[model samples]
Target: MSKKVIYGIFDDEEILLNSVKEVRSNGIVIKEVYSPFPIHGLDHVLGLKRTRLAIAAFIYGAIGCVTAIWLTYYIMILDWPMNIGGKPSFAYYLSMPAFVPVIFEMTVLFSAHLMVITYLFKCKLFPGQKSSSPDPRTTDDRFLIEIESDDEKKISSILNKTGVTEINVKEIS
Candidate 1:
């Protein structure tokens, strides 16, 4: 049997919320939601869990910090021990100001890059991956809801109840 997904298109936030409510009330499961802009309280309406990006970012930042400290200490103390202007080679305590820039840059670099990679991986958006978005216009001025089901009658009923502006169906091969 072919897997089917019902896509609903909307132009307004209120109508989107109402449509979600109606579809959910009918015991239909929403596969995904796409929106052009952030809609207030829409995540709550869809019962979506909050993203853990902040936590991941913190962990990545910590990794960056450790890497920076290790690299700086190894280079300054062991590899190339250079004393500039009578300053101690391992003057980490006194030369913290100089190291701050490196640490900050590494932290930002690691957090930003790692967070993006993790987010993309978690969202199943790997390189050369194709997503099944029915309407490209949903990325601009429309909202799209994808519901997984093969019951056309139930899908049509739900769409009618939710006042969906446009509807389409796609089969996953």
Candidate 2:
């Protein structure tokens, strides 16, 4: 069935939070919430699952470290080895300390860049990506809660009682 969404626009974070709780407690399904700033405890109220970005970051960092080790070993110890500062160029263990900075920097670089890319991809955001927020005010000073249900009467009653300043109803494809 094509769903009709109701957006309860709120003027304050506290009111939005309270309204979310009230609506959900009454057996209504909230599709999404938009806010100008982060709302503390909102995730808990929404029952969102924990993110796995940390695990992905760790794997990216491991890959970077391994790449750094192989590149350093191949260049410094095998391919045209240089007698840098009169240090032994034949043994990688002897030049291990010199490669520590490179390894650390590569690890941080790979993790940060890859993690951000992954986040952007997961969110379906890229250059020139069109936004989906129905009201532009949700990105500025307002908080919006989108509710999905077939009962318009119940939805309006709940939203009106919960201090919603503006309400917009739309059937989106």
Candidate 3:
């Protein structure tokens, strides 16, 4: 099923930000806003909830830390015990300082790479995926706002006052 949506195109971020606030204050629901770059505080004005990517990063880092510890312990203490620098290979604690760099690197590696993968999956963005933006200009110098509403004239009037460069109406599935 397809529904009618109003697209308000703006040239400036400040105008777009103020327009969003004004639209929401007037009880108009905005579906999405597309921009070329991140606009600070737009999320707050849009009333979006905080993301959980930080928690995911911490968990991924923990897994990497544990894996590094296990790998070092198994290789140095269990698999092949080698006496180096007068330190006994059988005791993990005796040579734990040498594994600190490996542990830190592994934690950082997992946190960085896994967080990127998690973000890509969450956004459904992958190789060969077509763009979902309503206007190609939004990826350039324009900002586009998507609002699903049956009343077109009222929205168009309000958006016109908010300084939209152009307004377009379309049916979206």
Estimate candidate 2's RMSD in Å.
1.7
Instruction: Compute the lDDT for candidate 3.
Output: 0.94
lDDT of 2 by residue, 37-132 (tens): 989999989888878998999999999999999999999898879876777697999888999999999999999999999999998999999887
Question: Distance (Å) between predicted and true CA of 96, model 1?
Answer: 3.1
- Model 3: which residue pairs collide? none
For model 3, state the Cα shift of residue 40 in Å.
1.1
> TM-score of each candidate?
0.83, 0.93, 0.93
- Please give, for residues 7-93, the per-residue lDDT of candidate 3 as tens digits: 999999999999999999999999999999999999999999999999999999999999999999999999998988787786889
Candidate 2: C-alpha lDDT: 0.90
Q: What does candidate 1's lDDT look like per residue over 1-173, in tens digits? A: 67788888888878999888888877888988899888898888888989999999999999998899878877877688788898877766666677888988998899999999999888899879975667789778999998888786788777777778888887877
lDDT of 3 at 124: 94
Could you give me the TM-score of model 3 versus the true structure?
0.93
Order the candidate numbers by TM-score, best to worst.
3, 2, 1
Of the pair 1 and 2, which is ahead by TM-score?
2
lDDT for position 13 in model 3: 97
**Number of clashing residue pairs in every model?**
0, 0, 0
- Best-matching candidate per TM-score: 3
